[model samples]
Target: MTVVAHPTDPTPARAPAATRTAGRIRGLDAARALAIFGMVTVHFGPFPVRGDDLASAAYRTPYGRASVLFAFVAGVGVALLSGDGSAPRVRSAGRRLVLRAALLFPLGVALQKLPTGVAVILQYYAIYFLIAAAALRLADRWLLALAGSLTLAGPMAIVLAQRAEPSWFDAGGNVGIRAPVALLRALVISGYYPVLSWAPVVLFGIWIGRRDLHAPGVHRRLVACGAG
Candidate 1:
């Protein structure tokens, strides 16, 4: 999008241009702000509070769910910003995603050294970014199918890996620690929103982006879906 100026009505004070721009998507920004707040609450640790009762619930609720929503919105934003069916623009966008992933992978590993347990989302996000970019050129139906299949198959794959003989896929056991290689390995595993399962959300976002958000009856259907 294009940002347009709105005339002030009967008020002496004027809102900044940036503020006006932000107001266009107040809903999205509000949702993002709530997600950030939830993240801070989850990461703040149970200092004044204790045990896994409320704390665990908080961690799994609003925070985890909001983070996933934010990721999906991010994918939608990417698709919207990249334009429709423009190969060169998509490739350029993909290059930027690759660069971001390269930077984030190391940062994610560094963050994992902190006291917040071994689980880190950035590494998985980096991997997702790269994979999603590769799949961007495909037809929407194909993209949707691949994403849906991978997401559905991921749990089965994990279960099979767990049941099978010891191998690299056995993520349960202890492993060696070379910071560089470890980061790469963790990027491949040790995360809840694994690339296989998470790509579908991004693909769904792409599908939404290709549609007319302002079309009559569209928002109603979306609201119904959200309700369901």
Candidate 2:
């Protein structure tokens, strides 16, 4: 007796990554737009309540939130640029990031000279960008862990620094380009957007960007975690 063999169906191929509209992620753009708009309002919007200005809708809603989103977005951008841990490309990207940081340092100082009322972020952002180069090769879990660690450590350091030197953070408006010591202090420990505390957000973003963001499971997790 001879037995017949049955044929099995072939596996299906996966579709390529999807982008919103065309060649871009609308969700990212929308979040960025919210951040930018919030920052603008925080700076240029009116203060109906004198000493209570900070508690106003604009400041209360976006003052810190926008900056966090902006930093996270920046990290995500870097992760994408690095091709999600592609070492060879990250090396080349790191060079570009270094040059960009160099340019931003002076530009931030220059912006300070312009008498802009808002606290400038470019200088601190430059430092954050440079630091990111060192961690570009870390796995997503490690990046997330570091972010969590930094988040906890940042506030503690801030408290200690304040106790050590209360006046170190006060800028009296803007510290000119000549004040390197004050500038460094502000970048590391104090200032509206201290890289000390904010660095974690950036790392978390880099980790998030490396994941399969378009997938339903990932999206669900992002929403749940973001809300938490």
Against the true structure, whose TM-score is highest? 2
| True-structure RMSD, every candidate | 9.6, 9.0
Q: Please list the C-alpha lDDT of all candidates, in the order they appear.
A: 0.60, 0.72
Q: TM-scores of all models?
A: 0.71, 0.81
Any residue pairs clashing in model 2, and if so which? none
Instruction: Write one digit per residue (lDDT tens) for candidate 1, span 1-228.
Output: 111223642211222223323324544566578778776766674423456687676665765676677677767666655554467867887888889889876676567667655456776677777876776676555666776787688667656644773354544212233645544443444345556556677777655554455444556766787789
Q: Which number leads on lDDT? A: 2
> Model 2 segments beyond 4 Å from truth?
1-23, 49-59
